[model samples]
Target: MSDTARTIGVVGAGSIGATVCADLVLHGFRVVLVDRDPAALERARRVVAEAVRFGPMLRPGLPRVGAAEALAGVTTYTALEALGGCEFVVENVSEEWETKRAVYRELDRVLPAGVGIGVNTSSIGIGRLAAETGRPELVVGIHFMNPAYLKEAVEVMRGAETSEACMAYVMGLLADLGKEGIVVGDFPGFVSNRISHLFFNEAARLVEEEGVEPAVIDQIFKRCFGHRMGPLETADLIGLDTVLLTLDSLHESYRDDRFKASAHLRALVADGRLGRKTGAGFHAYGLPAGGTGAAQG
Candidate 1:
C-alpha cells in the first residue's frame, strides 16, 4: 500500500484512537485523525511514530513502517469538516451519549453519501447511535480491543437498521487491516462489555466490602480460571473512568441492579485515577506478570 491509499477519518485522539491510527498507517491507509484538542493530536502523532518504529518488535508479522512513510499516512485536524473527503470514518470519542450524539449529527452533514461510519464504542448500542445520523444503515459497531495492532479478531456489531452494504464495507476495511470481524447483534455493551463490566464491578466491590486486595482478587482468576488479565487489571488498562461510564450505561440500559457500578469503582473515576493512561488507576496499569508489586491493591 502507498501513501496515496484510501483515507479513513478517525475521530478522537485518545489512547485507543491513536493506536488505531497507527494500525491504519501501518497497513498503508492514509488516516485523517480529528480532535478539537491540538495537544491530543500531537500526542497521537508521537504515539503513531513510536508504534510504527517499535510495535513490530512484539508482532513481527507487521511491516516496519518508516517515520516518513508513517507520517505521510496520517494528517491531523481540529475540525469535523476535515473528514468530508474520507472514504470511511471511525468515531472513537468518549463514551458519552451527548458527545457522540453531537458528533453523529455533524457527521451526517459532513460525510458524503455512501460513506460508512464505524462506531468504536464500549457499551453504547449501534442502533441508538445510528438514530442520530440521517444514514442509519451506514452505521456499524467496530469494537477494537486494546493495542489494536496486536488484536486479530474484532467484534463487529450490526445495528437494526444497518444495511448489508454497510456491513460489507466495514468487513472489507477490517480485512485490509489483516483482522477478522466477528459479527454480533446490536445492544448496549454487546457481548464483551455486557458481561465484562459485571465481573469488573464485582471485583471492585469485593475489594471495598471484603477488604480483599486488588492483586489478590486478580490472582485467583488468573491462576484458577486460567485467564490472562484479572477483572480489576483489565479495568485499569481500559481506564477506570471509561469503566464507570460503561457500567452506568449498562445499568441504565438494563435497569438491573446487577449492572450498577460498584461504589469503589465510582470513587476511582471521581478521583481522576484513570488507569495506565494517568499513571495511577489500578496500581498504574496493574501488576507485572507473575506479579508481586504492591500496586494500590
Candidate 2:
C-alpha cells in the first residue's frame, strides 16, 4: 500500500499503544493516535521519538531516524473523530469492556465502511467486540506485547465473522512492520494471556504465601526454564495494575479460580504501586514515565 493510503489509527496511549505507534512510525507508516487523556498523548510522543532515535543502537539492522522526523510522522488527537480518515485502525484501549465498547461504537461511526479494525486486547473475545459494530467481518484481534517494536510476532485472533480479506490485509500490514502474525481462534485470552496471566498470578501467590523473594522467584524461571523474562519481572514491565486487570478479566470470562488474581496483586494496585509506570510495584524504578504524537491513550 502507498504510504498515504496506509495511514493507520492507533487508539489508547498506554504502554502498549505508545509502543505500537513507535513500531508503525519506525516502519514508515503515518499514524493518527487518539486518547482521552492529553497527558498520555504527550508521553506516547516521547516514546516514539526515543524508540526511533535509539532503535538502531539495540539492533544494528534497524533504520536510524532523527527524533524530529520520526515525531513528524504521527498525529495525536483527543477526539475520536480524528480517526475518520485512517485506512485501518489498531484499538489499544484499556482492557475494560465498557471502555472498549464505547470506542468500538465510535469507531463504527467514524471509520469508512469496509475499513478493518484490529482489536489489541488482553482477554476480551474478538467476537464480542466485533458484535458491537455493523461490520463484524472487519474486526479481528491483534494482541501485541509491550515494547512492540522489539517483538517479531503477534497473536492474530480470527472471530467467527472475521473475513479472509481482512485477515490477509492485517498479515500484510504486520509484514510491512517486519513481524509475523500467528492466527488463532476467538477464544477469550486467546493463547498468550490465558496462559501467561496464570504465571503472573501464581508468582504473586508464591511471594505472598511462601515468602519467597520476588527476585529469587524470577531467577528460578529465567535460569531453569530458559525464559527471556520472568513472571515477576514481566508483571513489573507490563505494569502490575494491567496484569491484575487482565487476570480479573480472564477469571470473569472463564469463571475459573485458576485465573483468580493473588490478593497481593490486588493490594499492590490499591496502594498505587503500579510498576515501572508508577516507579514502583513488584520492584522500584528510577525513571519517570514519559513518551508522545503528542502520544499514550
Candidate 3:
C-alpha cells in the first residue's frame, strides 16, 4: 500500500500509543487511535497537539505541519470496530496475556484479511500473541521504545508463523516513520527488555535491600557508566507498574530468580505511584498539567 493510502489503527491511548499516533500523524499518515477510557483519549489528543507544535525542535527533519493539520488526520474512538478501515493495526494495550489475546481476537474478526497486526508488547512472546489470533501469519512484534516519536530505532520480532510479506510491510512502515527496525527472533522479553529489565530489577533491589537512594543509583549509571538514563529513572519513565509486570512475565518465562520483581517497586505501584503518569514513583512530579505530567528526578 502507498503511504498516502495507509491509515493505521493504534489500540490503547497510553503514553506509548499516544506517542506512536503523534509520530504517525506528524509524518502525514492518517491514524485511528482507539482507547476505552475517555480521559486517555483526551490526553492523547493533547499529546499529539503538543508534539506537533514542539516536536520539530527535537526532530528537525519531521514534516512541518501546524497542530490543526496534524490533528486533522487523527480520529480517536473508544470502539474497536472503528479500526475496520485501517490498512494496518498496532496494539499497545497493557502487557497482559488476556488483554492482548482479547484485542487480537477482536482485530482478527474486524480487520480485513492479510492486514498485519503489530503487537507492541514489552515482555510477552509474539508467538503466544499470534497463536491467540486467527491470522497468526500477519501478527508480528514491533516493539517501539518509550516516547516512540523521539526514538529512532525499534525492535521487530517475527512469530513462528509470521509471513515474509508481513515482515516486509512492517519494515517499510517503520521506514516511513523514520525508524530503524532491529529484527530479532521470537522470545519472551525479546532482546531489549530481557537485558534492560535485568538492570532495572537489580537497581530496584539495591534500593530495597541496601538502602541506596534512587538518585544515587541513577547518578552512578549516568556519570560512571556514561548512560543517558539510569535504571531507576528509566523504570520511572516506563511506569513502575509496567516494570513490575514485565519482571513477573520474565520470571515466569525463564524460571529464573534474576527476573524477580523488587519489593520497593511493588510498594510504589500499590501506592498508585505509577511514575510520570501518576506524579510519583521513584521520583515525584508536580500536578499533571495539560493532561501530562513532568518527570522530576
lDDT for model 3, on a 0 to 1 scale?
Answer: 0.86
TM-scores of all models?
0.93, 0.95, 0.95
Model 3 CA deviation exceeding 4 Å by range: 1-5, 289-297
lDDT tens string, model 1, 1-297?
Answer: 563598999999886888889889998889999998998888778777777766777677887889688987889999999999999999999999999999999999999998889999999989998999889999999999877776788999999999999989999999998899999999889999898998999999999899999999889999999998899888887778888988898889899999888888888888888876666766754432112221121
- Residues 191-259, model 2: lDDT tens digits: 998889999999999999999899998899989999988898888888887888899889999999999
Backbone clash pairs for candidate 3 read none
lDDT of each: 0.85, 0.87, 0.86
What is the Cα-based TM-score of model 1?
A: 0.93
Q: What is the lDDT of residue 82 in candidate 2?
A: 98
What 10-residue stretch in candidate 2 is worst by lDDT?
288-297
Q: Cα lDDT for residue 102, model 1?
A: 95
- Clashing residue pairs in candidate 1 (N, C-alpha, C atoms within 3 angstroms): 275-281
Where is model 2 more than 4 Å wrong at Cα? 1-5, 291-297
